[model samples]
Target: MPRLLTRVKSKMSIFAHRKARGMLDGEYGSVFKGRSLDFEDLRAYIPGDEVRDIDWKASARHGSPLIKRYVAVRRQTVLLITDTGRNMAASSLGGEEKKDVAVMALGVVGYLAQRHGDVVGMVCGDGTASRSWPAKAGEAHLERLLRDVNDGTALTSPRSSIVEQLSYVARNYGQRMLLFVVADEVVPDAGMERLLRRLRAQHEILWLTVRDAQLAGPGVPGSANSGPEDRYDVADTRFLPGRLAASEAVIRAYAAAQEQRDGGREAALRRLGIAHVHAGSSHDVVPAVFTLMERHRRGK
Candidate 1:
């Protein structure tokens, strides 16, 4: 309802002011400044330095730890991808709607692309359909992208299938761009893996998985208090017996399965050479994104 991009910028500004104390030491600016960067010099390691940037051999020689610095070069076209489906309207592990976190993550990355003089575009939909917008540079366009995700995602919407959207990108867009994908935990399949491989060969891919709410638990937001009266299926709003879900055995099994699902997703992305991260709420988006960016750059 209100201006969404402004909220995105506010988060970015928070990260910006933390630059000096941030992992990249303000080099966070270079996270979206295209792909490649020329090697610069090393600086003394700080408390928050990213371990990936540590020149291990150099550190050993220097007798202490050091962080590698680089000057970013070139620009990038960022394509924000997500699934606007009933699943996203459901709650995230962090107790907020998955769609809300998806929007925030998309907005953060899109704004970063904009700040670095890059154009941003989008591809979103569900199991039944897909849609896209042309790449453009402007806060207005980014706002529209965020709104598209926020407005389209609803409990009554179609089922989610991120594979469908990725397939669309592979078929329609030939240009090489940074694909920033945000979606809820999805069951990985061979078809999805194949599509990811195809897209990986054509463009650089980054994935942000929005953690799902705990189904059977005591500590989760909707677990103990919600009882059987409040819980319902996101797909069709069918009431689920919370008593069954609250069982200790059910909770343990659910947790184990979710862990495996998360691991499988991460394994798939890594095996395909794509950088991936997961976020449970808006607060986790920026840092998760930074981690994703760092992984993407290191792969490059």
Candidate 2:
């Protein structure tokens, strides 16, 4: 195994150890809810036994009918779509860098989905599909998805539109599913429409945008007075004093603009009978995923 994989395994072992002892059980909750549907039990069959579940060998040995009992299917499939583009690198928040935040958010949601007896799948998007695996349940499957989600290549690519990739995945899946999308809030209206439309038609979609708090609120108390420090031109990487105040104002303006854009997108999605949720630091991530999953459950 690679050194990084060993490190990940070591950390995971610690987490699993803690979980086994019930120390982290309350925080992570229970990943298993009773028995899985994949198991089966054998029993003697009587009249009107299910022909499909007949145990021929047992029936012959006992000179009586035999049947097979199966557990109920307990898992659902989930697909997560993450955008890793140049725009994601923009970090206005002091938290882990934007890319790191995005990856962590994906991991939290993916991990939770797996815990709930759900098969987790991922499509790391960066102009093109970086890696995609069919939804599957179990620790090994979750680990592979995590490895792919954490890879450096997942976030590197030329500017690529999400519309095309969203369409491809939606069209390819024959069954309905729940999809989680992580991306910057500001995307072209046309791109948003195409992507949302495809998801609405075939699956339940949740859109989560990760951005800096400063971008979320520019009118806060100290925010207005600290103005000049925020103004930096990306093109020139040069700072403009006093203008930092104006820069804060511009950031606020852009935020509002994006908000309005998102509002319009929400309305459009609702028209298509799709639900939407907008999450920021105020809600953290676990709650947001729960909210989205609850919404999906209700929709069904």
Candidate 3:
């Protein structure tokens, strides 16, 4: 666990530096971007400068348009809402367990929050049971939070509904926060969508989907198209049959369904004004997160 923590921190350092540079250049956007600002100086107004920031009196005195400049006052709250259900325990296309990728994703965001002097917290659950750690700052607190997520996921049962866990978050945590929902490839149903909508009204939401190998579709190495003899197991406990042969029709149907499911999920989140990142494997997690942050910063 310590080694994992160290590795995550090392990777996050590069991201943090990139973020810092982006913030300085006004190239990054997200709730993590400090909102509170302290007046720094005045400068000649550029064409695209906000009219609200224009100092009319100063501009009159200087006989030219001028705008106020302020340095961002840094402080924020980031909450990592993780799904520790059995599905997350499955292997991803990139060969690592989804659970491990989740931890690494959480670590990246949490470490970045800490570096920016923000409090980091978590709500982790495996459909049946959920655990939450209060927001706190400092490396020690972040480490403890990671350890708790690791321990909690290890002991929890798999068949838990991520919706229930998210419902818990919507009801319990009231204050406005930057919330990141990290989970497997399950698309939200109508009820789950409603809950997410309600939560979205109160917090800035980001959704990270950790893609599973079984769901990555036909072309992936272990996917149905890999061979006619290949068999795939559906990761849930429902009456949905577990194993399926790699018949051409089955593979094509599975790939189409998976694509539709993933597309629908992304579209729903987009409609709700939630930013999202898709990490296909452990190696993709950090880069995916960085890209999301960068896109948000650019207001895309």
Candidate 4:
């Protein structure tokens, strides 16, 4: 095969595999099927109850067991807010750019929501106020929604606060909504705190940080040592754990300090009753969304 053709084929294969895997896991896009109350399971027939939910064949073998199932309830609206500030556009992570990760994560979450029959909307931009699309369900809506995210990221300039934007979204949404914010881990300004506290009174919020691996830890994944011959290697240059490695314990200690700061901010948010999750460069957005969703679902 021609070299270009071979590369294209390889890329196509990877895409196909990823799409298939996502579908198998019941994650295709943002629309999620709401839970229903109809019973779904069945066990061996039991005693002292209604005779409706029994497995006769299994009961025959065991002589007296039973099974039952319930309807799953429908899902509520899911709004994904992403920070496209310059901080996110640049990456300290060794993999994709932080903004790229944010886009992909939003796409995956939107796709899952589309699949599940839930309305998925987005609020995007670098500042407090962003371009908003009201929550809507369906494949077409998801495509349009993702387009906003992709386009919005390019339009956002460096901004220091997200609070103004968050507050605007909170008012527009009004009712309880599942909110997720994909952004960098930079310290929020005072405005951010005020907006978050205000939103706390009305919305369920989750903050997911789409950060680089170097930010998450101190090393690169799947990369070999750098040498004179590899001067141009992106891998060699991308991982800056050296900033920590060179100082020996000091840098590591500093990293720990930063982590503590990050933790404290996160803890403070939680105290106000917000949920937060960190996404590393290597982490796929789909699974992360599901993990957060499952946690929220189970909690309720």
Highest-TM-score candidate? 1
For candidate 1, the per-residue lDDT at 217 reads 67
For model 2, what is the alpha-carbon lDDT of residue 104?
Answer: 51
Q: How do all the candidates rank in terms of lDDT, highest first?
A: 1, 3, 4, 2
- lDDT string for model 3 (141-208, tens) is 87777676666554235664678678889879987788888888878788888999999888877778
TM-score of every candidate: 0.81, 0.61, 0.78, 0.62
Model 1 Cα lDDT, one tens digit per residue, 219-267: 4564455553435667656765678677888779988998899888877
Ranking by TM-score: 1, 3, 4, 2
lDDT of 2 by residue, 1-300 (tens): 543333433444455553445333233232222223355778877788658678788889878877878775667667877765554554534433455556555666666666567788877656645557888876677667655645543223455445655766765776666677776554447666766776676666666666543432332233435333444432234544544445656657767886787787666666665544655532244455445545544552
* Cα lDDT, all candidates: 0.82, 0.57, 0.73, 0.58
**Top of the candidates by lDDT:** 1
Q: In model 1, what lDDT does residue 64 have?
A: 99
The list of candidate 1 runs beyond 4 A from truth reads 21-75, 219-230, 235-238
> Each model's RMSD to truth, in Å?
7.2, 9.2, 4.8, 9.5
- For candidate 2, what is the TM-score? 0.61
Error of 2 at 28 (Å): 14
